[model samples]
Target: MENPKKDSKKINDLEQNYKNQENTTLTTNQGVKINDTNNSLKAGERGSTLLEDFLLREKITSFDHERIPERIVHARGSAAHGVFELYESIEQYSKAGIFTDVNRKTPVFVRFSTVAGSKGSTDLARDVRGFAVKFYTEEGTWDLVGNNMPIFFIQDAMKFPDLVHSVKPEPNKEIPQAASAHDTFYDFVSRTTETLHNQIWLMSDRAIPRSFRMMEGFGIHTFRLINDKGESHFVKFHWKPKLGVHSVTWDEAVKISGADSDFHRRDLWDAIEAGHYPEWELGIQIVPQEDEFKFDFDLLDPTKLIPEEMVPVKIIGKMTLNRNPENFFAETEQVAFLPGHIVPGIDFTNDPLLQGRLFSYRDTQLSRLGGPNFHQIPINRPIAPANNNQRDGMMQMDIVKGQTAYFPNSLGGGCPHLAKIAEGAFDSYEERIDAKKIRTRSESFNDHFSQPALFYRSLSQYEQEHVAEAYTFELGKCMHSEIQERMLWLIAQIDEDLANKVAKGLGLEVPKSIEQPINQAIGADADIQKQQPPKKKIYLDKAPTLSQANTKFDSIATRQVAVLVAKGFSMKNFKKMTDVLEQEGAVIKLIAPHGGKVICDENMEHKVDAAIMTTESVLFDALYIPGGKKAVESLKKESKFIKFINETFKHCKAIAVDNEGEDLINESFVKDYKDDKAVFINKTPEDFVKAMAKHRNWDRRTIVKNIPV
Candidate 1:
């Protein structure tokens, strides 16, 4: 019988081999040890005579050049390091090694960004969000570049530059820093027929996600998936938030932009650090090759979507962002995403937008990163060893030892041979292509109003009202009356009632009808009459999952709760509530009248995280006012504190009052206090805790008056 000890000994030997790799000391480029990074090298007695210091010079030079050119579109971004685990084998759908092995845990880096924003822009901008992920698999680095919206504004890649330029700040003025509420964007929307569907989404709540963790991600373009048997299937990728899709009100989002420009980044960092890891389930919507043209819209069109109602998503794996980036510049900023970066079993479709991205991403990185050898950067490098004949570009890190670096070289004995099919070399699907080069779109791609109408019809009554209000607000900002009228006409095409609502708010009459298409030659059919009438809304069966009201709010994890305190506050009650909140994973920030420290009635000194003057009610999820006799008196006199309580009540956020704190609320302008869902009475901490768990009180908006205008 074979001895079990022999197998254990072999495993031990491998472990020892891995351990034998010596750990190196942290040092500078010149091999000098780094004693203290907190303080830079300085002259004696801080005299500022450090020109001869090599350490300081090197460090300053590195810091100065740390930033590269940010993405032209998705300039503002945040990233995290995580691992993706496959729950079950998907070998039948794809030969991708990462999906074949259920036991494998692949290292992943995910970057979420706001498109059309500068590097310094606010995180709450109403724009398409970039949700790109790079998987460092053993086979290679596979990048899935996607967006929060499943569909795009244009169908072809050639029109991408035009679309981006239209949405970006106008070249001459650059007035709107990170917003799409402008004349130029509205003009583009009115002129481009294909943009209607995406414009509707942009005008909706989906554009203002509460947090990066609460948003869904989608690969906008259809792709090809291949199995081990060489069988191919058309597929679209999706990443569903485990917390469920949720969004902030437009008013809340705008206020958040002012209160905290780094709201999304802060949320992600705080959540991960506090161990409330953000998770998403990896899902795919698959369609057979034969059914590619079976849908109403062409499979190659990027502007169309195969609704979940039509083809349900099959969740296959899970990804948890358990770690934050060690350094922002090195990890988050330098990491690049290219759509062309795919491993075996994963291939691209002929979707024009995707095809263009495949070329544009790599080309942009070459210039932005300053060289073709940008992949050599530690953060961008693949975990798998790269061995190829391509060599010698700017900043080349690899040191090749062969005499010949080209293929079919006798000097190198024909080394670095092409990988075989069994060795996991990428192979494209055998799709037939026999079309003439033309600047025309398929007829099936022409009917853009149907899906937009469907989306508008799909929203709940409250959501529809919000969408109408959002359109009015955004259009009111535009100085051009014609642009607003044209947009109103477009909206009317989506829904007559929606246009009428927005027009009423704008104090302008809606146009009788938008311009009839001058050039209606679309799709293969090219019948103008066929495109005149939008399709009947088929998705009216309320998809409760599409609404933000259904999102997970049971857990208060990662929620920021502002606790009001002062000298004479009830120490026992405050401690009890604080302990329960902390245990429930809520972060408490002590806000006092003064900035520094506060002494409790029990003679305990607690430091204030932020003064009432520094933070706003909009910055936190909930507010808890602990009873202190003197504290209540001081808070009553402070208008900012009163504003905080009043604004929190108006916004429909949870507000809890204890002891004498109840008297302060009674004196405030919140008159219909008893009917407000946010205002909590009685002394029990349990009721307050339960109210806080509800996240927001939707009923408060009806009764509360004198809310922040």
Candidate 2:
């Protein structure tokens, strides 16, 4: 058995350097022992947290500014401490130690976040999710700053600020936080043809994921992986979740925001704490540099994706996030991720959006983390010894031994010299760049509709319906008729049926002509007519990999199952179902009519995880009910219990009932869902487990559309 603690020496050493207060008296920041943290030094017994109270002042003052400036985007985040291990060495593709060393366990800190939301925003927002990972590798730190989607909204770095500003809340009112369903966003999207590919995806089920563990992540740019021989391959990195891609419906997302605003953050933390650590297979599409222009779309374009059918992803390793952050601020908040943090073999490309990020991320960290010494922060520090001539800045923790802060100093015996190339010295791939110093756009990046069309065509009918519904809901939120009209026209360019469906929902006609300068995202002198998007091509028909309908449904592991019971519930049915599910690594919680404990038919007491009124169906992945006349009748009294069962049915999640549990179902919407495949009545525990592994029954998707719960 491999002991994770023994293998992760980097984390162990890092922890040793931390000021752990375990089994110690509470002390002030200046190391003086404190007595009372409960009450302040008040003038009277009931006075305010006084300014004269040094102890109280220290605590309050620290807390007043406890929060650093939250990220402008991806402010709401959930992070985990993990380790990445290679399955096999791909030394030919890249010589980075984290990629090539199969024996080494590289400690990693991964933060998952929503792109549009503020720090206090809801996790269920209909926006892009940021997937940023920091690998504290032997060579140095490497940050893979990416998103859940493979493509982005813009092609150039210059338009990034404009894109973020438009998608954010309206500048005047600051209304509708963490959402893109506004006039300004559609205004930007309607004009920029490059935004179509990612805009369509945002309208798909990928935007609002069921859990952080159940989504795929993409590098979103054409990065380079160089070998020791200095050979470069255009690579697109992928993080394929083992639990498979899954999501809640838009209706569910809206309700879940109210039900549990910390849905994703809680799900991730609970899963890891329960020993069901989430895992992802790291894969890369290694496209030869010479074959970059072989595809119809430009490789340098951030708005385009190289279809898996064209260049198959090569699975390299697996990353398991086994631990939650020890402290949210020390680890999750302060940890910085930059695209510029690369090793010898991994390098950047000319992807404009990526080039912008390489600069933006580094600059943002300096502001957010106080100074350039942010790298010295424990969470952001590299495992390897950082010996350099770069001296003191803000928050410089290291104590320099000698009077040598400059390079080429003979007094300090010319110490801290640069490492040789063989000793893992950092080096960029020497690619020749001889071009005119002119501000001109590449005509190759103009064809944007084809990949979006390809993405839409690839999804299953059920998935397609979700996309259409998402578009209808988003566009319905916009107040401007002109914005909606132009959006409808853009939708028409992607698919006529999709456009017509949205038009019908909006109660408007798809315009014959809306705007002539559709591709107006160019310089002043550029010919408007000549800059028109080229005809979209049908390349490889359908990339099935893009569809979540084709995701793996192999395991029900770590799924949240809510068990409903009250006084005198069946002990037999509860034990039989839970024993199997618990064996399969599912976390089962007992929700009763009241808090505290519930008495089973066997007179045995079981702890109640949540009362009927306290919890909602949106918080759970599935529902289980055990038989007992008293238990069923008790659960029947609460209206929320009925709503709970109805909401679960409407969401198409698996529901299992044993013996008298059918009685409870009879009182709710489950009476109408008798024939539903996922609604197993008096089914065996094994059968319920199998159904849950399928995630949800899609056949029920059409029928349960109108259930008002």
Candidate 3:
């Protein structure tokens, strides 16, 4: 499965088109290599630029129009090139080439984004993350446009615009660019009961992922897989990260935003560039069409997720992102993902949101990508050669060669003939539809609180506390008292205790009853009260899988371990820890008092990765202080070094110290309870590695909660 990109003709095509300017002369857009790139053509040495200078015009013109229209949503994004390899062919499930052909390496481009943010928004925003993947399979591109969470905020596509509007910055002020805490968002969530499931996830730790590599991805909709036998099965796709799901605390998240707004983006890019590529195991939850009605929650509802306990996830394949995009704008920015771009075996369901997305995505590309010829963009182009009579308009990069452009024409000897089922032509599944069109909510889509309640209940006590605190913080940000009150009443439906905590924070009571319409979204003839979310019913008491506590903690691969060092550092202590950690795929960066090189105890010089003032503790997963009498003495003089360790301790990150390093820790907040599980004092590197693998020592959180950095 390795070097999957090397075998992919599409990836090869991109590599062929990719240009490198290293050691080459600078050039204009017209490819005339220039020796005077710095000095634009001018009338005189210091005169104004001359309009007669074609080189200046060409360079400035390209720079002026370099910016294209950004996406309306999921605007802030980072992407990578990857390949998907199947472990076992699921011929019974899907007949798609990527699924059935075990030897085939499917090229893919993955884009991770924040939903509420604009193009310039911070990556650490508390909002939904878009995890969209475009697979260049033999048939065509299959774009699995999804989010980190399995469920979404709204179920109906018609309400999507409203959801985005409310969650986005306020209309008049445009305040709070990338955040969800505001009057409009709270107002919408208070009434739109369907949003509770995903909004709860937003309030939880999942929203603030430690790294993009650690976040789980999901295809929220219930898509279908039609096999060669013409049997259709309902399918849900899941990407379980190899590094495991993990997140930073809200306090850390805020600090990280200030310290490094591009934390996740940088992490993802650095990981790939360092050869510690991100990988995720593909899992599928397949339910037969006959068993669709068996679930308590509607399978077709975009707001609900099928508990993995009900139908176990089958690990099918693995997707490894190995390459960083050569050009951000050309590859990552211009990559358009459409939910409608599916394969022969894969088909859509009647999920209203998915249905609307099918039309909306293509329509969006017309404006965002500058026209209907978006597919001609190299990133969007498929490995499979496109042979069709469809002509293009704007940005028409392709030149279709044919006298007879019309289909079924004899003049061109039946050129561009239609493909048959055997020739791998796409044919829609023969799904029987025998119902009149009606615009109304399904009775099955009404249970909004059960899954949300289930999600809350499945969390560990500490996770639940975080959720409660999140609710309090978000609601406390709202300006309108009525909006906060409505949200309190809504939260009460999910958990009375959580509601009580949030209400207490706002100095408001959790009212027993708020209004007639718990859900204000009702039809013209429907009863306002009747349209309210149905009383939650517990089908399964606890889906332990829902909890982050249940996620993988087996390995600490690619975990960033900050090694604090100084001019007279302990080479022995440093190498001892680094050797073991690097063997486990952990990356250690030397954080010194100053930049450049620092001499060790052995008088050996080492390159400093970052200076104490340049980096923050929130940027690292763990901290290591090596033993050196002079080094520790130097660290003691610097106040920021102590604060760094203090913040790391407060954030529940693992901290390891040895020899004189113990003296440095003793001078800081680690002086108290140095015996904590995650605090390794004079312990072996193996002990620190084990502690780091656990992600964090949440049990130590209560004791260190009051630590100020």
Using lDDT as the measure, the top candidate is 3
- Candidate 2 residue spans exceeding 4 A from truth: 1-68, 518-521, 527-531
Using TM-score as the yardstick, the better of models 1 and 3 is: 3
> Clashing pairs in model 2?
627-660
Q: What RMSD does each model have against the real structure?
A: 19.0, 16.3, 16.2
Candidate 1's residue-wise lDDT over 1-709, tens digit each? 4332346666568779877877454467888875433222222211121234455445534432433587777889999999999988888889998988888899999999999889999999998899999999999999999999989997665456557777888989787888989888887777677788888888888999878998999999999899999998999999988877767778788889998999999999989988899999999999998898778777777888887778889999999999999999888888888998999999987675675566567777876787788888888999998988878888888898878888888888888888899888888877655444333445566686878887887787767877898899889877767778888877888899999999999999999966653323233333443434544445444445556666666777667899888777888778888888888778899998889889888888899999887888878878888887887887787778878877777777778877888878876666457556557765566677677666667655556544553
Task: Score candidate 3 by lDDT.
Answer: 0.85
**Of 2 and 3, which scores higher on lDDT?**
3
- Count of clashes in candidate 3: 0
Clashes of each: 4, 1, 0
What's the true lDDT of residue 247 in model 2?
89
lDDT digits (tens) for residues 1-709 of candidate 2: 5433345675566567665747476678998986444322322211112234565445534432323578777888999999999999999988898888999989999999999879999999999999998988899889898999999998765566668878989989997899999888988888777888999999999999999999999989989998898899999999999999998888889988998999999999988998888999999998898997788888888899988988898899999999998899999889888988988889988775676566567667766788889999999889988888878889898887888988889999999887898888978888665443333356677787898999999999988998888888888887767778988988888899999999999998999977644453344444544545536789768999999988998888988899999899889988989999999888899998889988999999888999887888888889999878898888888888889999999988999998888888898877987888888998888889988988888889878878888
Per-residue lDDT of model 3, residues 19-57, tens digit only: 543635556666787543322332322122333556544
TM-score of each: 0.86, 0.89, 0.89
**What TM-score does candidate 3 reach?**
0.89
